[model samples]
Target: MPPHAPRRRARTRRSIARLRSASIDAFAIWRRRLLFLVGGICVGLAAVFMAKLADAAQAAFRQILAISPLLALVVTPAGFGVAALLARTVFPNSQGSGIPQVIAARHTHDPALRHALISLRVAFGKIVVMALGLASGAAAGREGPTVQVGAAIMAAFGRLTPQRLPGLILAGGAAGVAAAFNTPLAGIVFGIEELGRTYEARTTGLIVAAIVAAGLTSLWLVGNYTYFGTTDAGLALGGSWLLVLVLGFAGGLAGGLFSRIVILFGRGLPGRAGAWIGRRPVAFAMLCGLGVALCGLASDGASYGTGYEEARAILHGDAAARLDFAPLKFAATVLSSISGIPGGLFAPSLAVGAGLGAALRDLFAEVPIGALVLIGMVSYLTGVLQAPITSFVIVTEMTQDHAMMIPLMIAALVADAASKLVCRGGLYHVLAEQILARADAPAEPVRRTA
Candidate 1:
């Protein structure tokens, strides 16, 4: 061949190599973006489904209650018992607030454990059992289950990419919070405070993108409404600050007691009681359901479901809730939680806080009921979660009230401190430890049925 021909051939080879490189680069970029887009879409769709399910469950419960209070009484125990049985038989590793499972998936080293904790089956079970709990008049929320659904969706999508499991879990969880509450900032804060526990530079963009996408999806469907609706009320900053202090301590004590009870029950009942409960979990769940039913009857149905309507009503200056709402809702929530069903405490906790604020309304006649409701929400949530920033931001975002930021922050801080005094660790973290312990144990063949 001629020398010129050889040089031409070399140039052609070089050009083809460059073209191939560019094509690969473009493909990689598209794949990465596609993964994110799909993940976000899944998270958003899951959030919307969770929201609808929650609403439907509550509506069903209300219909039953209206038809006959006695029917509700019969339904609650049967519903809880059947749900507990289904959770044991059909959906292993799908019980309690789903946040713990996500946390376990994020932290565990074993791949099998992570998969067991957060998977498509578990996500489906979480939604089904949570709805069942709500339909039965068991106090529960969809927000927690949404987190698991989001995490499972994102994690499953992440399998298509080179993303790490922890980042995928974190991003999905944050997206769940954002979409569920329609509070994107709070979702990011939740990622930092509860999910990640420390900001990671690598996952920041992913988390933000997922949150924005999921939040927008929720807004598109729900019309940009706040979780608790808007409030124009603000405090005068003088003696009103005293109201914040009082509310902080009161809400803290109540929230701390709640945390302590839940943690103790989660760890296991003491001695013979624990053994008995372990053996007859369904029966125990039925008894707990009875307690919830009684609480609901006592509160005239205020203690049933997620407590969202009652809390929202109080925030809007409606006096429909009774004075004993706080205690009744608290009882219902604790009982429902200990029954080992798939549900969340977010809504019920906020409701308990709102009821506490309403109860204190007699003392703070001059303060706006809306403001007090917001304070109690932040304070109690902080107490339960022990994440002051997340609690405050969630309350602020849900209320759409920037004016109460300072008071809300103060209440959260105070409540966090008080909660620490009662409970050694946050609820989710403590429960996560249990999952970790189970992961560390030797693997056993998981029975498909109870």
Candidate 2:
């Protein structure tokens, strides 16, 4: 061979060797990553199972209470006390709504802070506490605790895997919401809009898979039924379009105020009276339960448990027996939420909005009640979550009302914008800030020195 030809052949061989080495390295890295990914999937599925089981348990328990509202009020609160103790001691970070904790977990860089597991303790604690809150007429929903429980299960498995665990945890959290509420599409939307922060194809797939699995699991166990009974949800259209727009604007304002009040009242120290109440949660819960029971006595137990039943009654153009109990419901929910007793704001928020909407429907007989309630649902949820698309899809799907699409979309946008104007941070962000502050307060010296 010529000298030049020999040199060229040697260089080609060297180049080929380098390429092969690089390919092997890439394969090794991918193989490891694939193993981690599989681990995440397993973690996610386990989370789905736990979340579904918890949801089923809570629903069954609540159904039993539904048969006797007063007993539910008393018994549930006592259970809440036990759950609260477990949560406060075991996974304090998991207390209250899971959304804030999840946000903190995702945003915080400290692995230790993020290392907190979504364990069985947190799950069962939240479930019992939320049940108690609901039983005692706490103005809260079960979805929040279920989400925490779901994330805890996911986190357990996520801890076994690599850094990609947060994504899996988020997917599982969303699935829990879907399973608990039996709103799969909403769960997917919530994962993207609220938890994922920014959507990517991989995250989307994980969330979608988790939601589909959990939703199917829940449906298989519980059968299909909207939390609230089905409604007409059709828009009257024509002249009333303007009215709907106005309502949307108003609803947005209401939602913003509601969120603000919750964060403010929840965080600010309430002086001696507040301290006294906080100190005696059990007694306070009992008193509140009694108060709710007394007020509910008038209407033969009309306002109770997530407010869906009453909202349904209102949508049907029938007066709720305890129409006057809306205020009581609001008060109980606010207290339970502020007490950090493991519950969600969404159900209470929806109930409050629906109640207001139903009242408006009564006041304005010309508009469709279903449309009003749908608008209210979106308006309130968007205002608080600041996730217009998620809120919109959730309510729209719940009603399956294509005709009200325009109004629902419009309402969601207006409410989101208006709520933003009032508070730059959404409700979850506000709560997360408070949680972080509380977590960091004691470590301030260490952080400052560092």
Candidate 3:
């Protein structure tokens, strides 16, 4: 062969190598994007399904109540028992609101914990059990479970690209919040404030993209509907300042007490009583359900399900929920949560806040009821989650009440501060710690994978 011919062949080989490298790079980019898109779509579809299921559950419960309130006494306890049995027997690690499980998975170093916490099996169990709980007059929300479901779906996708697990989990959780509430901004804030707990420059784009994709999908399916509908009510900045202060303090105290009770129960009911309950979780769940049923009876069924309707009515000033709604709903929520059933506190907490506002409205007749309800929601939710920005933004987006932004922000911040004074830690964080502790136990059985 000629020397010139050899050099030409070398050049051709180099060119082919470069072309091959370029093609690989392009394919990698496309694959990553596709993964993200698929994850977002999955989360969005799950959110829509969760929303519809919640609505149907509430409707069914309402119909049952209309037919016979007595039926709830039997149905609620039986449902809770059945759900508890399923959780223990079929879907271990799928109990309670799913936010804590997500938090535990994200914070833990153990791969098994992540697997146990966020899996397709757990996701399926969460959806089915939460729907059953709501249908049986349990005071629960689908939003928290959606967060876990979203995380599970994304994590399952992440198994395909092992390097992207953390970012994908974060994005999935944020996307779930976005789709659940139809509040993209709140989703972004929740990712930073609650899930990530710090802003990461690398993951910001991925998180935003996921949230937008999921949110857009939800908007397409459900339309751009405000969660609590529109309210023309506006607060007078001068006079409403005191109203904000009252709500902030009151809501903070109430929410803090709630967290304290839940934490106490979670830490195990204090001595033999706790040990007894631990041994008989199914029976305990039934008792808890009875408490919820009694509360529902007290509220005339107003405190059942997610309490979404009452909250919406209060926000729109179309109905005045009974003053007892706050306490009754609060009790029902606490009982349901401690019962080991799959459900969320987001909607019920908002309803509790609305009930508080309704009760307080009688005292502050000068302020618009809608405005007070909005403020109370921000305060109480902030208190529970200790995420002021997320709480205020969620309430604002849900109500489409930009006019009360300043008041809402102020209430949320104050509530967060007061809640810290009482509870010392946010609800989800405390619960996550419990999950981590359990996962670290030597005898804790590794969840079986499908």
| Model 2 worst lDDT run, 10 consecutive residues | 441-450
Worst 10 residues of 3 by lDDT: 441-450
Question: Candidate 2 residues 13-94, lDDT tens each?
Answer: 9999999999988985564345334433443344445445444554665676577756755565565565556556654665
What are the per-model C-alpha RMSD values against the true structure?
4.4, 5.5, 4.0
* lDDT of every predicted structure (CA atoms): 0.86, 0.64, 0.87
Model 2 whole-model lDDT (C-alpha atoms): 0.64
Candidate 1 ranges with C-alpha deviation above 4 Å: 1-26, 162-165, 441-450
Local lDDT at 398 for model 1: 90
Give model 3's TM-score versus the native structure: 0.94
Query: What tens digits encode model 1's per-residue C-alpha lDDT throughout 1-450?
Result: 777998999999999999999999899766765666668778988999888988998899889888889787689999999999989889988899889888878877777888878889899988998899889998988999899989999888877766454687888998999999999999999988887786678667767887888888888887888888889879996987898888898788788889899889888989999999999999999999999999988988889988898899999987655788999999999999999988998999999999888788788889989988999988888888888999999999998899999999999988888888888778888788777875684432221100
**lDDT winner, 1 or 3:** 3
Candidate 1: worst 10 consecutive residues by lDDT? 441-450
User: Which candidate has the top score in lDDT?
Assistant: 3
Error of 2 at 212 (Å): 2.9
After the best TM-score superposition of candidate 3, give how far the Cα of residue 356 lies from its true spot, in angstroms: 0.8
